[model samples]
Target chain A: MRLKGFRLLTIITALVLSNNLLAQSIDDVLNRGQVHGNFGMDMQYYQVDSLIGASETPDEDVLMNGFANFIYTNGSFSAGFRYESYMNALQGFPAQYKGNGIGYRFASYTNDDMTVTVGNYYEQFGNGLIFRTYEALGGLGYDNSMDGMRINYKLRDGLFVKGIIGTQRLYFEQGDGVLRGVDGELMVNDFFGGSLKNSKTKLTLGASFISKYQADQSSQYNLPENVGAYSGRFLLRHRKISFNGEYAYKINDPSADNGFIYKEGTAFYAETAYSTKGFGLTLSAKGNDNMSFRSDRAAGQQDLLINYLPALTRQHTYNLLATLYPYATQPNGEMAFQGELVYKLKKKSFLGGKYGTGILVNYSTIYNIDSTAVPTAENDSTRMGYTTNIFSVGDERYYDEINVEITKKFSKKLKGIFTYSNMVFNQAVIQGKNPKKYPDVYADIAVIDLTYKINKKNAIRTEIQGLFTQQDQQEWATILIEYSFSPHWFVAIMDQYNYGNTNKDVDGNFNERIHYYFASAGYVRGANRFQVGYGRQRAGIFCIGGICRTVPAANGLTLSITSSF
Target chain B: MKKLILLSILTTLSFTIFSQQEKRAMPSVNVTDMEGGTVNTSEFNNDGKPMIVNFWATWCSPCKRELNNIADVYDDWVEETGVKLIAISIDDARNAGKVAPYVNGKGWEYEVYIDSNQDLKRALNVNNVPHTFLLNGKGEIVWQHNSYQEGDEDTLYEAVKALAAGKELKH
Candidate 1:
């Protein structure tokens, strides 16, 4: 293994240096490089609020999380590093991020069709069924960048290959297990270079093999030190229709996720879509069984996850519908599907008014995979916990939801969007809590959003949202209003109320029913932004740009600053 | 390791201050178009016209408002300035397929694409969604802005019109 890696390093070095040979001079190369970066800082001052359960105050009074990235690129050569500091990290951030350090650094160069990177990098292979690495940074504080060497090369005009050998990042350090993977993809039409080269129908096929190796240190049950997984994927597209699918299978090598069960795991995902000028539709399906893949077996609750299974439900943005009963993917076992349709009502039609109206309908459902216990004399001495069929869905449902939205432009200065959603959330399963203690939550949500353009340099937006349920915080409503002063400043205020909370407090008073109000203003100048807000926060998952994080309930003053150069 | 990175950054900063000549070109990062076709960022162009590159996502409210507002005046902007607007979705695979539907549902006419893994986003140093950039006719990045407030498109339009008039933006 050592010799092979050395040879790969030598070849990559040669390819990288080949481009430098053609440069005019070293000074010329140095002069052409560019420096760019981005910086972000989030700070909060906590205040004790007995009403919202924010009783504990930090000893320092202020907590902050900050990071800055610096990248320099010169033609085919580029390098970058990220500096992160958490002065006793925020309330919800990972506790391990307590100090300042260079969290990420990488050196990469590309020559011709070959690119090589050493140090750290983020990559995804074929839907990330078996391998993916990324940094969510501020929101989740989740980063799994591989800290090692990676090489990507194009064998031909249509064939590409990438190989990586590294260990996953665990907070401030690297995980103990080592991961190795190689992937190849080929464009069928382009590779053939014949009748299908320019055909409307296009096809791409890919395959990847990834393996993780960890030393066995457990004295109880013998665990497989090496676990390998493979995935096959294809993309087929035509004029108005497209389909993509991937199937992954992994060898039996469990440590803790599945009670150390030795059952082989499998997952399959498929997505198809059709779109036209003013209409679009999509359908997606996923099946997974005992696919709890993690670099460290003992790690739990969003740690050391090597593979990813995207959630099939709609990503709601409204405060009530988004944070109350949001859906999260179950990595252990699930059968899920989603379908969505979007259509625009033509202008001049009865429902369109002067401007066209937009309509969106979406549905999603998730259920546990059917599994039956293996009847063994020694109580499953084989350790093959259960038998499962990919096609069979069990009676226990995880989540189900359907929603419809209508958007229309009432006039030149006014527009409104109304949405209604019905969902059944099995918190017992989705939250991994005791089933007997918690019942499934049934909710109906509604939201109305409006925006009025006061002028070219100012505007106002408002959102009224409500969520009604019989269980888990009975009923809730939220109202938000924001005003903008064009290219410079804006202000906003919001209030979330739990109006129908029947649960009583210790003094037989309905103290649980409360109002959480927050207000803030922001300023933007060129590439810099600064905002200050004071509010009461609830305990739930908040997502920003696809990254989700669980924030603890708190009452505080928050400040954020961001800039790029 | 931290010291090494700091040293390298300092050295690069000095080099930049000492010799700054060439304009920064678009990074060659591969992202998928809305139609699932691979497109390299280096090839992004508008046939000698100014281009507006906007980064957005489905779940981001401000991003949606910005794009929807742009759609209202897109035809006028295009006919008057001959500018091309490119909207890039920074959504992950979870919502990749929903992009086209959402855009079409709103009847937006901008060129749409997907950066599922955020390769181009990272290369462009986009810290958050609603980050907008303007490129000249030669496809060289000239002006950039982060985040958005309603009516911010007017400022973006001013930049586009200036670029179309063959003027350099102070940004």
Candidate 2:
């Protein structure tokens, strides 16, 4: 195996050396370039509480997570780097993110129709089915920025091409696999601008090919050294109607996630939307079969993932609905479908008052892909572990949800939002829970959010939410109130109570009814903001495909500061 | 590695300290329009008038509120100060398709674009949604603010008016 050094994402750009710069003094030259960056820091102080299993806390007591980025851009050249430090990272973050250094940096130059970059960067191909790399939110502690060289150019008026040769970043180190990829796109209307450019119909076509190379060191099986994937996508639009779809396929490569199965992977997604003034309708579908593609086959759980598979579902923002039964996309194999309708009732009409009312109806579901195991008789002849019928949904259901929301302006100074959701969460399937330990959760959630304007700079907002379910923790109710002193300050308080507890503890006793409470205040001025809070519950965790981490019950004071310049 | 990083940092510092005075300009970055066409941030123009660049998303409640609130008086803002608002949605590909329809459903008469990969968001150093920046006629970012409350857009409008009147904004 070959070892490659130099893992940096910052751009060390080549400054301009034109004769025009020689005439200017140092101050003049330096003052021409602009510098911009942002800083964010999160620190939490913990208090031990034995009730919710927080009896012991870290010796550090106060854990901090922070980062700052500095970028300077002048004309066509830009260079920047990010500095990250996690003094014992915040709770529920990926364990790998210890003390961070420079996570991302890049230098790039764009001239004429071409641009070149060396160092760390993020890139994505059509729909990111074939290849994609990016950094998650700071608190997520997930980043897969690439360290390499990327060149993008406009081949013609409507034709564009890009190529990347790099390796994925894994924590502070680089992945074992080397990656190379190329992408090309064509705009039909722009390419042939005679009549097509002015026509109401618009069309775009694109294709991407990516391959990864890794050394074979396994003694158990002969692994493929080079694994490649390719995809094609197109978008068509005519007036108010738009349609787009992408299909990707990868060569057979045995990996740990698939039990070393030699089944080739295929995935495809398609969506169509029709929208007009005050009304929008959309439907989308996707099928994934062994679509998990990672730089290092040995890596596990979001490590070195080279592609993104979006779970076709509504990302609820409400507290109970978002945290409780959210469905994660099953990458290995799943068939998902979603449809939504967003419409606004006309003013002075039924259900609409002086101001119009906004209505949203959404339904989404996911099911396992149908697959049949290969006969043991011919298993070794061709090690294709199983065969799947494309888009064929299996009998087992993974997740299903239907929700509706109504936003209305009741009076001149009063507004309200009401939402209701009915979900059938396959806890045993989606969360990989034992059937005996947890049953399928059938839940109904309702939320009422209201805001009243007391004056120009003063307003009050309230939220009343309830979740009723027979499985997992029973029923819960919550209430929140916020006071806003506009242009500067805001204070809010919230309390969540587990009213109905039907589940038994490990000691065969009833679980404690913990009324998780929190209070916070914040001040914002210009581009800087300061927030201080006392909380007793952790935020929601993102569990992509049933892989979830337990968010410890927290009791602490939190301080967060953010600034941009 | 540490030495190399340190050296690179020094070079950038020197460039920034000497190159430009205190003028902050929008970085040139590419984002996709609703029509799948790539639009460069540097190409944003409003006929030599002040422009409001707002970074928002569909899932953010405060962002939705701010945009909706502005929509009610957008025509007045234009007539009074000729300020053009460009709402940039940072929705990833998963919800990119819903952006156009969602924007229309809400009846917001503002220029909208999708930063599907957050290229523009990162370039502008935006920490969270509702992060907004005001640019003068010359395209220099003059003032910026983040987060939103019920009446926050009023404060933003005041700055836009000041910028339109060629008044120095108190940052």
Candidate 3:
């Protein structure tokens, strides 16, 4: 512990000296006493019967989280800090984070072609498959924020390069390991000069190299001194078409998650999108095997995540489906495909009358990539690298979803949408970890949405949805009605019924179904608005991008407010 | 031809209305210069200068590229449109102290703003770092961009010069 303290003090002294020695500005120091800050408040109330292993808490209270940021900038220099306070923060937030303190601090400067910064900062490379740092307020996670040094340089034409080296921040302290990376990019907007500018084509090429090094835990395994990762991406854009693809490879460095020894990993992502006027199409695919790389291999969600692989599945916002079975990216041996198409029917012909009609169809699927582990010698009992068979694919699909929607404007004041979905969900892999919860086939969902515009100031929307799944849960139906007075006021009411669960009680009666109802109202006066709702929120899967988290069932009142000056 | 003229007239009318809209509300600040001079934000509008306010961090790879991209076109931008850009650094104190020497080493030619406390961030509702806000001569925000890519600066320049030349964007 003394050695650790000494090392930290030494690092801080070195950083402070480096800051003072370079670009000394007395004028900035003398006159930079101005104080400016920003404040925000968020509160949530939760009532849950079962959350993880915690006992049912019939408590009713509000969780408050707010931050005040103050910055003082002088010329090419600035220093700032953030005061963050959380009193029983939002549900699902870590229980340990309840105190208020200076959460972040930094000083920075930039010139035309070069910029340098030292401090705690957030950053991302490409789609962040290899490295991304930023607070995901909604996700309740700030994966990577480094207390470190960064340097950037711009070359001739469109060539650019950047390098960052630092210790990732974990909570209020730094991580046990170190994260470093470098990235370079070339923009081909006008390739050289102007002759090709008129051509209807554009291209961008980029390459990035990242490395993580952590001290070996002899008690765990003899880890490699350095584990390196490299990724490359290409982007192309034409009038109506755009395509992007990235590939990443990593050197083996094993931890507890994958046994003791290192396992080499690789990941690939590609996406293509085409849009013209009212028509759009997108197709994306990703494949990965043993690719979950973190700075501190031994640390799980508590350490710094050097990369973030964006999930390709469309994030569904509906509460019921979002809470039950959210798909999480299987970083090890998974192949996924997603495609979507949207078209606006031309006017005045059959299905496309005076009021144009629109149709959208989308599909996504994920499967395991067959893999084999290398056998360890009897004397050396450790699992190191694995060999992957090039020709073998998993025998069964993990998840598959197909959905379609049709939307039409029936009149000047009316519009409606009808949607249908067919999905085969692997509860074992996607939701419940129990192998007994195999794939649930033929889960069908249907939805109808209608909106009536009484006038420019008044409008109403109504939605009805039903889901039929015989596997784990029962048949479900939902109805929602919302009324709005354009410039200011709005109200909404919704109810969900679970009528088809397969579970049975001791009396042989199918699990007793449940119904949840909620009503909410809001009044918006310019930038200041307040909204509150009361009701029971059923359990469901909540997904963003392709990352998902399960939101447990709960009964409570939800209130939100926003004010701006 | 008559219908085309009508469409053009309607477009002009819509642009006029959009241009008349009020800028988003934000707090004020005063930044000191390298030579110890103070530059107040409120004076920016009265000075009849178009300010390009870019929020960036040293660790943001895209922000670095974005600065480089703009630098390549900056001279032309200033010569033809007489616009000024202020790159705000959001690096905190631990790393904040290194920014000056680093910028000097790179030799960039834009005025810089240090927003350690993120005063401007909350004022602009910056959900993400590296968000850029372009303000017109009257200090009304005219355009903005969230993320950066290799060729994204071209679109940004077009908006800046167009607004400087007293023309409203079509979209």
Using lDDT as the measure, which candidate wins? Answer: 1
Residue A202 in candidate 3 has what lDDT? Answer: 68
* Alpha-carbon deviation at A71 in model 1, angstroms: 0.5
Query: In candidate 2, what are the lDDT values of residues A214-236, reduced to their tens digit?
Result: 99998777788999999999999
DockQ of each: 0.36, 0.39, 0.03
**Candidate 1: segments with Cα more than 4 A from true spot:** A1-27, A375-381, A539-554, B1-20
Best by TM-score: 1
TM-score of chain B of each: 0.88, 0.87, 0.78
Worst 10 residues of 2 chain A by lDDT: A542-551
Instruction: Write model 2 residue lDDT over B1-171, tens digit each, in one string.
Output: 567556655665566555547577677788888777888899999988999999888777778888988998999999999999999998887888888889888888999999988889899998877788999988889988888888888999999988888899888
Order candidates by lDDT, high to low.
1, 2, 3
lDDT digits (tens) for residues A213-261 of candidate 1:
8888877667788999999999898987889899999999675688788
TM-score of each: 0.92, 0.92, 0.71
Q: What is the DockQ of candidate 2?
A: 0.39
Q: Let me know the TM-score candidate 2 reaches against the reference structure.
A: 0.92
Can you tell me the CAPRI class of model 2? acceptable
Interface RMSD of 2: 8.6
